[model samples]
Target: MGRNTRKRRTPLAAKALAASAALALGGGGLLWANFHASAHESHHDVAWGGNRTKASTAQVVTISCPDVGQKLTDVPARARTEVAGELAGLDRQITDAYRRLATTRDAQARDAGFVQNSILQPLQDRRAAVLDRIGLEVTRVGGTVPTGLSALATCTGSAADRTTGGGQDGGGQQQGGGQASTGGQQGGTGQQGGTGGQAGNGPAAADFVDITKVQPNVPAKPRRTRSASTGTFTTRCGVNTNKNHNTDNVIVAPGVANGAHHLHDYVGNQKINAFAGNDTFLQGGTSCQNRNDLSSYYWPVVRVQDGSQDFDQDADGGGKEGNVGRILTPVQAQIKYVGSPTGKVVAMPQFLRIITGDAKTTTNGLANANAHWSCTGFENKVQLTAQYPICPRGSKVVRTFAFQSCWDGRNTDSANHRTHVAFADAGGNCQNGFKAIPQLTMRLVYDTTPPTLRNGQVKNAYAVDGFPEQLHKPATDHDDFISITTGGLANRIAKCINRGQQCS
Candidate 1:
């Protein structure tokens, strides 16, 4: 929805946009997953991007309604005040079903019937028409829409920790059998009937070790500039130059386009995408310096184009210069990590994907403040624009990425992804209730010069692989990841981050 920057406060942490209210999503929907935090949650069994639902012709989500009739007793406050007339009645029915299902201990017994009937069925039947009405109503209301409005469209369940802007909750059972973040380090729990009732635990000297936060955070982040080292407990993993990709546990449908948009640059376990299972690569091989490291990492390929330049989307027919041709592999990659207070490392969840940068250069197109762009020798940096500053005589251009290190010690991903993970402090320390993992730091360096030949025979840069029907431009630059890293590797990194070892 917006730029894929790390959340900045400490719920694991992200700066509060407005102190904790319901979250706002792409098309004006709000999501709220009021779940308590927990600790036993190591990795998630769901897809990489969280429990998000898409309108699929090939895949149908069948939900059964409660035995209760299609009437309602109480209406949501937002619906009462914000929703208009006939639509208001429909909104109340939807909310009432959710309310019943929310408190029903045996909700799962219906075969996810409640969700299929209440949320998905009507949505599927009237996709275009319903969305149109929702959009119209959202505009009439000053700021709020019906609270679960977007969730119906997405089917990501009732909301877990907030992740993206859409506010889709990942708490309830989504896609049949997947775990949502019930409780995290702060001692919370999920609301689902399956594992929601299970008691959480503290660190055991046995298999599950506690990863504490680093204090005084070694090196503080420099103001207005990127810090190479916060002197934190981050370590670098290995990167392989192999050509392989696997799609299993992800949420991909045979012909759906929502899961992945283009060709991906994969590191570590080869099999990954919207359809790869979490266990697919658990014992899989790696292309990193350490063969033991199995964390899967992926992102859209960066095509170095003989640009007509970016940021000129509507201005100069420069759209053709955005991205095209074959997606190229990174010359080399480096895996960086950050640690917890006690400097213990835990297993990263599956399908943890983050998209940064805009795909187009239109002023009206969505862009993020966190999308950083700069040249090696030039001190100035840019964000969310297709425009790139020319580098000096021999310097290279770069895209520097810093993923969140601190986790809530529970959920693998929040609705927006960033909520369960937050940015490291200036001191590189996590927030009060959060634990630290290996924060991801990446740099995709482009040093090649554009071709000088003609016949219109000039060189062109390509974005990640797609259907060739569209171009993947600079504005759309982003990254994807899968946690296939072995458990042993995590512990060793914990040692390094704890002892402050700069292990490669």
Candidate 2:
């Protein structure tokens, strides 16, 4: 976005099926049975037979399963790889089941039990099998497995209201009429055209709010103390001009292809993928203006629903997984590091990984949801989390991610990839046993047309790519960062902050 403004017109080749083929080739092996058991358990029965009418009356929009990754707070070093792979398998199972649900709408209309019996039940069985393997792997390595793993295997069908696309009023309260407006203005009532967005899976008419009508919700800034660092450092990283795009997640599911099940736009480090190791990052080239900053930054790509398909239209994490349309690159990508407001900050450990928001927020609830959506002009006045802002002409859309600023000081990574880092408190103080570190904040500005709502339908909608079952909801938007700054560079940043001087 800084220099390369032209969009890449040529579509890349579709991803090969070698990864899936490899999995299939091992189906007859013992590892396959351990990872995927054919035996089905009926302990957790779904209430579908008698709830047929209810299911038919209210459409099931997506599948919701407990996120096993979030539950695994600790794992022995030897078992981490195997457990992570099984967790990825759990996600794959859910994606496969969602595809089944989307294509069987006709069957669901005819039989109320179709979704439950054919989709959810089988999904539960597959998850249970994977969960058991995860438990066994941890226990086999002398690590105590987290309890209640079996209880998390069961999944249920989630309706639209319970999901991110659910209707909400101006104050962020759930409303039955699908209205989200402020100052007596009514939002879109375009229900005649059916649910909007791609594959009828997201960004409903209720998901948009006129930014002009939103009230000023920005809180007052915290008062800085005498010991405050007060300085900042900025890094110039182009807005993915080289088009480093992928569906793999090196942080969450290392060595597994297509683990994310959604496309990501990457900036900074050039040699990142699901199979990349720490050594790869240390030796890799970068896109940042400062070669010393070899860190990696990435998030899900935002796509415009303009009736076109990208190269991955038929591939696993693209259109085939319900993420369709033309991808939009941001116009400006600002990466900055700010000092602590309470005291001098410490240098972060090299290779430290931090994931700010929850990608499964729609189903996992709002405990860790931190998405902030607004327009460039209204940044100081309003920030919408669950709904996309319909900006006035001349104002561009913006997405901001304020990463965790406190570190546990013991590990660069955690089993869940979160416990090692945390956000500062309202008073800008780190919690007990945690130390303050320079906060990394990314601000991305997009030059795109604001979507419009007419007759209760959304037109020209843009949404963040997400998990197949996540429906590309705004709340599921998240960011990932890997701190690969050289030790000398990190020390210089800390010194600049402590001296109250801005540096690059």
Candidate 3:
């Protein structure tokens, strides 16, 4: 199986508050390009990448475990204990293998080895053996095993033609592969990808592969999106599609590089990230829907890799031009306001400098996998493993982003630049103690067919225009802020998104 991996800006009142917050394929089968966010990636939404078919329809053979649910049948409880021990052991092996994926030396090759050696084969083999024993014991005790027990016993997928949305056959923990074999049905919005290539062994006893394993696929989840609009009127910060270089912060200043080798498309506050303080941002001009927003919103410079260099790709002349060679300009930057999820809007903490998408990635290692990527219709997306989905002919590839909206009600810049705030759920709800702030959501779009290369390659397309030594390319691509958007920004968000007003 493979693993892998939008936006807004705004203001408001009455309700103010909170906000917040990969890939790789291992092995020689596919030479996955290098495009992944780093540890900035966390254990949150794990919706994977790739096409996926639904549950299988193969008749599930049953072998229910008799009253075994009562802890341990007359059999020695050691069996359960042994299972637990095996799980711990297997987990450690996975952890160890994943650690090697991040190593700077031989990263890509390590990932492949980890996938084939550590995960793919062993997970289905060694792990399944332990589970197989459990199942064999059940029938010995006259246990009428569940139809899927044969597969579940090994924490594997069911080797059957599934019923799309019908439940799993073997009653194993869904997490243990969840019978995740994707079939040949093409998928996306209305398309359902195919099922897994059933294990070579006969159906009833084959090792059920995970949906993600057989095919680096993810089950479809609702694609959560919020567009900015009013009943009869809607506007974006009138596109300012130019490469802003002066504000590129090339002084080799603190926190920023000497000269960001990449470029960022600035929309809001005319002047920002020029190493300005909060007051400077509050005073800058804005192109927000109404031109009143003073809140500065900025991100990595989107560039068309046609060999056009704004500043030297290597300002310091280190001879290393972190240029990706042929990148494309982002079609548009959709900036909108995000408010509290619960009810009334919460106030945003001031001078918040939120950085999304890692900017320090290189072929060596991924500094952050949270550098999110997805298409127009995908709700549940993957991270890191460069599982970029190629948008169909007319569909669009979108980099949908959600900035941290929950403020600690204190400093904007944190020691690490992120912990100072949090984000809300799709429903706008925030966590405890965190005051909700009108968040910024930016959805950068690319309208062409995905290059056979991929969206990760797209990310690798251009670097953020900053200092050369800072090594802030696709990984260092991030954003900064200073709220000055007149109260109107927050009000509008509340009325439309929060209050159930369907405005796009």
Highest TM-score among the candidates is held by which one?
Answer: 2
**Candidate 2 per-residue lDDT over residues 103-162, each given as its tens digit:** 665667668887779987887788888888988999998988778978887776655333
Residues 420-501, candidate 3: write the lDDT tens digits: 5655544555567776666566767776433322221121122233222222222234455456656565455545655545
How would you encode candidate 1's per-residue C-alpha lDDT over 1-504 as one tens digit per residue?
A: 112222222222222321222211122112121122133323222110112222111111112212110111122323322222323233233333333433342344335565556555554444335545654554554434434443344333432222222211111111000111111121111111111100110000010001121111112233322322222433234333455533211322112222232345667665554434555656566666677666666655554432233332332112221122233455545557654433344545544433332221111122121333345643232221222333445765565555656668776544333455655554555678876666666766665452221221122322333211112223234455555555466556656655556775
TM-scores for candidates 1 onward, in order: 0.47, 0.83, 0.46
Model 2 alpha-carbon miss at residue 488, Å = 1.3
Query: Candidate 3, after superposition: displacement of residue 300 in Å?
Result: 1.4
Candidate 1, backbone clash total? 75
Worst-scoring 10-residue span by lDDT in model 3: 24-33
